[model samples]
Target: MELDEAFRFIGSKGPLKVGWYHILLYALLVFYNCWIIGFQLMGMIFIGHVPKNYQCTPPDGFFTNDTTPVLDETTELDKCHMYEVQDGIVTQNITECLYGWDYERIIGETSIVTDFNLVCGDAIYAKIAQSVFMVGVLAGSVTSGQISDFFGRKIVLHIALVLKAVSGVIMALLWDYNALVASWFFVGVFNQAIQISSYVMMTEMFPPEIRTISTPLVSLIWGLAVSSVVPIALLFPNWRHYQIFISVICLIGVPLWWLTPESARWLISRGQIEEAEEILKKMAKFNGIKIPNSFLSDDKEIPLNEDIIEPSNKGHDGENEGEVHQQYYLLRAVTK
Candidate 1:
C-alpha cells in the first residue's frame, strides 16, 4: 500500500464506530493539551502572592481627639491603621533598608533589583534559560512533523510522553540552572510535538460533518490546561515539583493511548481494508448501532469489489459520487 493511502486509512478508520470510547479518547488528549495553559497562569500566582507581609501605617488624624499634641515628642507610632485606597498594595518584602533612603524608593525597578540583589547577570541567566527552553520547543515542533508523518501519531505521542517524563525527572533532580534549561528544552520540543500530533490525529479521525466542532472541542483542552495550571502549581509549590506534576499528568496519557482507534482513513489509504473494516464493525457493535444491510453485506465479501456502487449518501447531499471522489483524492493527498 502507498504511504498516502495508509495515512488516510489510519485517520478515517472507525472514528464513530466505538462511540463513547472514541469520545473519551479525544476528550483526554484535548484536555491534556489544553492543560498546558494552566501552567502559564502560574505566573499570576507567583507575582501576586510571593511577597513578604508588612504592617500598614495609620491614616493621618488618628492621634487622640485633641487638636494639639499633649507632648512635643509624644507621637506614639499609631498601630490603629485605617484602610486607604492606594495605587498598589504597600507590602513588606525581604529588602534590607538602605542607609540614606527610607523605603529605597521601592516603587521603581531599581528598588526591586536592589531589594532582591538582582544583577544584570541574574536577568541574563534567566533569559538564557528561557531561550534554551524555547529552542527545545522549536526543535520539537520541527521534529514532530517528521515523526508523526513517518511513524504514526500514536507512536510519536508515546515518544513525546517519554521525553516529557524524563525531562520532568531531570528538572526535579538537577540543581544547576544550565542543566535545567537543557532538560526543559528537550521537554519543550518533545511535548509540543506530541501535542500537535495528537491534535492532528483527532482532526483527521472525526467525520467531516463534525470536524469544525471537534476541532474546537479538542482545543478546549488548552483552556482546561490554562485553568488548571495555577492549581497544579499551588499543589506542587516548587518549580521542580511543578515539573514532576506535569510529568505525572503526561504519564496518565499512556493507558488511554490504547483506547484510540487507528485512523480508518489512513488504513483505507494504506489498502489495509480488512483491518479498517474490522475496526468499523467493532465501532458499530460497541456503539450498539446496526450496520445497514448493504454495508453488512459489503463487509462479508472476501475482497471488496472495487466496481461495487457504494450506498447513497445520507443527511448530506455533498456525499454524492462526485464528492466521494473528491474525498478519495483528498485522502490520497494527505497520505502522500
Candidate 2:
C-alpha cells in the first residue's frame, strides 16, 4: 500500500491532528523564519554611509555644526563650495568634499561610505555592491528551488544554512572591498536558498487542512523580525559590528536544521520508504498514538483500505461529468 493509504488507515485508528510532536516541529520552523528575516534586514545596514552634514574646513580649528574655521565671520558657511578670502572678498572655489566628510553618529557608527571613502568619485561602487547582492537573491531563489526539487528539502536546507553562515562571517571579516562584494553575493544566495527550503518544508509538514493556516503564522514571525531589525541593528556600534552580530545570530539555526526531521512525504516520494516509516513511527510514539505493525513490518501484500478511494465514472463521451451521480448511487447503495 502507498503512504497515503497508510496515513489514512492511521487517521481512522488515531488522530493525526494537533499532535505534540508536530506542534513542536512547527514551532521550531516558525522561529527559524523569524531569525532569517532579522538577518536579511541586517544586510540593509550601511554603516559607512553616515548622515550628511558638513561645513567648510577651518584654517585652524575643525568644521562643526555650531562653528567653522574661517578667515572672516561675514562669509556664510558654504556646504558645496570652498570659501576663500580672495582680495578681502569671500569667493566660491567650486569643489567637492576635498577635506573629507565629517559624519553624524546619531543613527549609528560609521557606514561603508566613511570606511571606504565611497564619495566624491567612489560612491557608485557602494550602490553597485548592494545591487550585486540583490542579484544573488534572484539567482539563489531559482537555484535552490530546482535543487530542493531534485535532492530533498532537508538536505538543501542544510547546505544553504552552512553556506550562508560561512559566507556571512567571511563577509564581516574581509578588509578587501572586491572580496567583500563577492562575499555579499554568496551570502544572499545561500541565505535565500535556506529560506525557500524551510518554507517549503513548513507547508509540507502539516496536513492539507491546516497548511493554509500555517502560511500566516510564518508571515507573522517574518513581520515581527521586520519590525525589530532596525532597533536591534542600532544596538551595534558600526556596520562592521552589526554584520558580525547578525552572522553570529544566524548560526543559532544550524543545529535546528540538523535536529528537524526530513519531510516524510519527500522521503516517500524519493523511494526512501524505510526512512519515511522511521519518521512516522517517531511521530506516532511521541504523540502516544499506535500505528499497526502489519502496515510497517513487511513488504508482503496488505489489504488496501477502501475509504481512501471512491469509485469514479466517466460518461460515454469520455468525460467526468457523470462522477457526481455515480458517487451518489454508490453512497445510496452503501447506506442500504
Candidate 3:
C-alpha cells in the first residue's frame, strides 16, 4: 500500500492512539530544531553589537589633563576622528584615528566590535560579516531541500547539526576578521539546512489534521525561542562565550541520530518498503495501535477504508474522504 493510504488508515484511529508517537517526535524535531535556529538566527544582534560610546585613543604624553581631545565648535572627538593636540593647544586639524579606539562597556563587556577593533574606519566589516552570514542562509535555503531529498532527512539533519555546532565554535575562536566571516557563513548554511530538514521531517510525520495545526505550533515555539535570546545573551556577556554557549546547545541534538527514526515517507519514496514498514510498526507500537497483516502485503490490494485493527471512530465516507484529500493537498501546496 502507498504510504499516504497507510497514514490515512492510522489517522482514522483518532488522536489518543497517535498522540504518544507525535509527542516524542515533536520533542526531537520541532522543539530542539526551533530552539537552536532561533539563537543562531538572532545571535548577530549581540555578537556584532557596537558600543554606544567610543572615541579615538590619544597618543601617550599628548594629554596632561582629561585625555579627551579638544575639538573646535564644529568638530568633536568621535570614533573615527580625533583632534590633534600639541602642548595643550587644541588644533583645528582633524585626523583619522592613528591610534586605536576605546569603547565604553555599555552594551556588554566585549563584542566583535571591541574584540576586533571594528570601530573607526573598520566598522563596515561588522555589517559585512552579518551580510556574509545571510548570503549563506540564502544559499542554504535554495539547496538544502534538494540535498535532503537526495540524501535522507535524518542524515542531512544530523550532519547539519554537527557541522553547524563546529562552525559556530570555530567562529567564536577565530581571531582574524576574514576567518570569522568565513566561519559565520558556513554557520548560516548549516543552520538553514537544519531548519529545512527538520521542518520537512516534522510535517511528514503527522497526519493531515495534526499536520495542519503543527505548522503554527512550530512557529510559536520558534518565536518563543527567538524571544529568549535576550535573557540568554545577558547571562553570557562576552561574545565568544555567548557563541560557544549556543554552539554547545546544538550538540544536544547529536544523540537524536539514534533516538529518532528516518522519514518513513522518504524511505517509501526510495522503494525501501521493508524499512518503511519497520518504522511504521514502531510508530504503531508506541501509539498503542496495530497494523493489519495484509496492509503491507504485496499480494493484496489494500482497501482505503479498511477497518482499523483497534476499534475507534468509523472510517471516513467516500465524500468526506475526498474533502480530506483535498484539504491535505491544499495544505501541502501552501507549505511548499
Candidate 4:
C-alpha cells in the first residue's frame, strides 16, 4: 500500500480522527504560527509610535509648550529647531535642538521613539528598524524551507523559537539604536522560521480531509492574535516590558517538544519506516483502533480498488478520488 493510502486508511478508521492528540497538536501549531507570528509582525505599531506632542527643549530659564512661538515672525513651535530667548525677547535665528526634545506623555509612558529620541531628524530610523525587520522576514522565508527539509521540522522550529525569544529580549535591553535594529532583525528572521516550520509540520501530520478546515481555522487564530496587540500594548505601555512579555510567550512551546510527534510522512520519506510505524501504532492506540499486523509490512500488497476500500465519512466522490490519487502520486514522488 502507498503511504498516502495508509494515511487515508488510518484516518478513516480512527487513528487520525479529530481527537485529543489532534486538538493538542493543532493548539500548539496555532500558538506558534498565529500568536507568535502575529505579535512579531504587528509589534512595531506600538513600539515605534511617534508622539504627536513634542517640541524642542527650552533653555534653563525659558518655559515653552508645543504651541509656544520660537520665532518672532510666526506663532509656530518647531519640534526640531529652537531659538535663543533672553528675558521677553526671542532671537530671530533658528537652530536645530541642541539640548534635546521635550515630549508630552499623551501616547504612552515610553516607546522606541521616545526612548531613542527618534524625532524629526531621526524619525526615519523608526521606519528603518521596521524595514530591517521585514528584510529579515524575507530572508527567513527564503531559507527556512530548505533548512527544515534537511533537519526535520520540529527541531528547526524549536531552535528558531529559542533564538527568536532571545533576540526579542536582547532588543528590549539594547541601548544603542543600531544594536536594537540588529536584534529586531534576528527576531524577525527566527519568527518567520518558527511560523514556516510549525505550519508545515502541522499540515503534514493532519489528514488531508482535515486540512481544508484547518487552514481557515489557523487564519482565524492569526487574525485574533493580531487584533489582540492593541489591548496588550495598552496593558504594557512601556516598550521594554511589552517586548519582554511577548518574547517570553515563545517559551510556552518549549515543553511541547516532548508532547508532539515528528511527522510520520517525514520519517517515512527519510527511510525511517520503523519510527513511522511506531508513531502510527501509538496514534491508533490513542484513538482506540487496532491495526492489522500486515498494515505496514513490506511484503503486504494492498489493492487500490475503491470498491474494496471503505469510503471516507465525508464521502468520496470522483473529485475526492482524484484528489486522493494525486496525493498518493505526490507522496511517491517525494519519497523517490
Candidate 5:
C-alpha cells in the first residue's frame, strides 16, 4: 500500500477524523513518551550532587561534655580544616577530615557526594560519571536510530526498555565506582533508544494534525517533572535508596509499552503487508470508523506491490516514473 494513500484514506474518513477514541489513542501515546522527560531529568539530581556544608569531623569525645572554648572556636568549622586543643593549649593545626567530613544535611538527607565520599578531591568522579552517561546517550542515539531503521521501532523500544531497567537497577546496587559508572553508561544508552523509538512511533501513528498538537502537549508534563525531581529526591534521603527508587519507577511504564501498537510504517517497510492491514483494520474499529477503499479494500485487499503505485509520469517525463513511485511509497513506509 502507498503511504500517502493510507494517510489520505484515513484523513478523508469522516468518522475516523473526528472520533474521540482516535484522539484518545494519540494522547495516550504522548503520555507514554512523556515518561522519559521526568526520568531524564532525574539524572540532574545525581549530577548536581554537592557536599553539604562539611567540616573536619571532631575528635572522639569532643562533644561528650558541655561547651568549651576549644569546641566553641571549632563550632564555626571550615571546609577541609578544623580547630583543636593540643597539650592543654588552644592551637590551630592542619587536619584532613581524617575522621571523615561531617555534613550539615542541607541539600539532601544523603547524596552520593557524602555516601560515596565523592567530595573534596573525589568530587570530579561524580561529574565524570554524569558526562559519561551523556556520551553513552550520544552513541546510542546514532546507533539505535540506524538499527531501528533496519529492524523496527517497537521491537527496539521494547529491548531498550528492558535494558534500561536492568542497567538502572544494577547501577543502584553497584559498590565499585568504575562498575557503577559503566552501568550508568548502559542505562543512558538504553534510555536514548527508548526515547527515540517512542518519538518516531508517535509521529508515525498519528496524523500530522495530531502530531502537531500532541508533541508539545506531552512535553509539557516533562517540563513540569524537571522541577518536581527536587521534591521527589527529598523523599529518598540516601543516594542508594534514591537510585533504587529511580530504577523502580522506570519500570512502572513498561506494561504501558505493550499498549502501544507497533508502527505500521515499519511493518509495511518490512513487507509485513498482512500485519500492516490488520493493524489498520484494528485502528478503524477502535476509531468507530471504516477504512476507505483507496487505502484498503471493501471488495478485495490492496496488494502492497510496487505495481500498485503508479509512476509519476507527469512530473518526471516518464523516464524514472517507476523510480519515483518506489521512492515515494517505500520512503513513506520507512519514515511514516
Candidate 6:
C-alpha cells in the first residue's frame, strides 16, 4: 500500500521539479528583462511630467516676512549707528529666477532671455518627440517579435541593446534637439524589442505548469526602474545630465548577458536536440534527480504523426501489466 502511494505521487508530478536556484535565477532575469514595462508606465506619467510650463506667482504679499534691509550704511563716529553716511549709491539686479520670464515681468521690469535653446521654447517639440518614440515602439514591437522568433532571442535582444547605447550617447552629448528627438524615438522602439525578446526567453526556459507564474514574477522588476528614476531626475536637475545617468545604468545591464542561458526551446526548434537534451538533463540534476540513461541518448525526438498513428499499444499495455503483475506476485509470495 505504501509503495503504491509513492508510485502514484511520482506519476502525478511528472519527471521534473524546479529547485530554489532555478527559481531565483529566473526571477532575477524577469525583473531586469522586464524593466521596459516600467519605463513605458513612466513615459505615460511623463505626459503629466512635461507640461505646466506656465509661470505663476505665489500670491500678494508673499514675502511679507522679510525684514532684512538692503543696505545699512554707518560711519565710525557719534555712537557709530547712523552718525555719518558716506556718499555711495546702492544698486542690485534681480530678475526672475523662480517665476520664469513671464511672471518675473509682472513683479518688476524684466527682459525675455532665450537662455534655454533646448527643445526650443516650443513644448510641442517635446510632445512630438514623445509621440514619435511611442510610434517607434508600436512598429518595433511587431518587427522585433518576428526577428526574435526567426533568429535566437539573445541576438535580437543584443541588437536592441546596441541601438539603445548608440542612440543614448548621441542624445546625451549632441547639441541638436532634432537628434535628441530622433534618438529618444529609437530608444522607445529598441526598448520594446528588448522586452519582446526577454518574454520569449523566459517562456522558453520555464516549465509549463509554473511558466505563467514565473513570467509575471520576473516582470515585477519594472517597478524598481521607475522608483530609481525619480531620485536620478531630482539629483541631476538637467535633462542631458539625467540622460547620461540613465545611459550608464543601461550600459550596465548589457554585460548581464553573460549570466543567462540560451533558450532550450529555441535549441530544440532549430533541431539541436542533443543540446536541448543536455540542458534538460542539467535541469534535472539541479532538481536533484538522476535522469534515466535513455534520456541522455540522441534519440530524443518523439515523433507524433497525429493523423496516421495512435499511441503505442505495446508500451502502454506493458507498463500497466508489469505494475499489476508485480503487485499480484508480491502479494502471493508474501502470503505463501
Q: Please provide, for model 1 over 1-336, each residue's C-alpha lDDT reduced to its tens digit, 9 standing for 90 to 100.
A: 332232223333245322554576677667655664245223324321222322222234332222111223765422223233234433323222221111122222121222332232343555455566668778877888776776677778776777777776776677665676677677678767777777777776565655767787655556656666656656655555566666766776578666666665555656666666566656555654434332311423122223322454555655465545323322222222
TM-scores of the models, in the order given = 0.60, 0.74, 0.82, 0.83, 0.74, 0.60
Clashing pairs in 5: none
Candidate 6: deviation at residue 263, Å?
A: 0.7
Candidate 4 residue pairs in backbone clash: none
lDDT of 6 by residue, 1-336 (tens): 121221121122233334544565566556546554454436334321332222322223333112112223752111101111123321232222232222222212111111222122454565576677788888788799888778887778777767776676676676666776677778777878877887787776655665767666654566677786666455654555555555555555577677555666676567665665565555545554444332423223222123323233346446543443222212111100
Report the lDDT tens digits of candidate 4 across residue range 1-336: 455555554554343445555666778888889888888788888888888778888777677652245544876566788776656566756677777888888545688898989999889998999899999999899999899888888888988988888999999999999999999889988999998998897788766778778777888788899999888888888989999999988987688778778887787778877777887777656655545553554544333334224443334553564444423222232233
Backbone clashes counted, model 2: 10
lDDT on C-alpha atoms for all candidate structures: 0.51, 0.65, 0.76, 0.76, 0.64, 0.50
Please write out the lDDT profile of model 5 over residues 74-123, one tens digit for every residue.
Answer: 75445654555465443556545556666777655765567667777777
Q: In model 4, which runs have C-alpha deviations exceeding 4 angstroms?
A: 9-16, 66-76, 86-90, 292-294, 298-336
**Residue lDDT tens for model 2, 79-109:** 4435544454444554544465555567657
Model 5, residue 130: C-alpha shift (Å): 1.2
Q: For model 5, where is the 10-residue window of minimal lDDT?
A: 63-72
Worst 10 residues of 6 by lDDT: 76-85
Candidates sorted on TM-score, descending: 4, 3, 5, 2, 6, 1
RMSD for all candidates, in order, please.
11.5, 8.1, 5.9, 5.5, 8.3, 14.4
Between prediction 3 and prediction 6, the one with superior TM-score is 3
Better of 4 and 6 by lDDT: 4
What TM-score does prediction 5 earn? 0.74
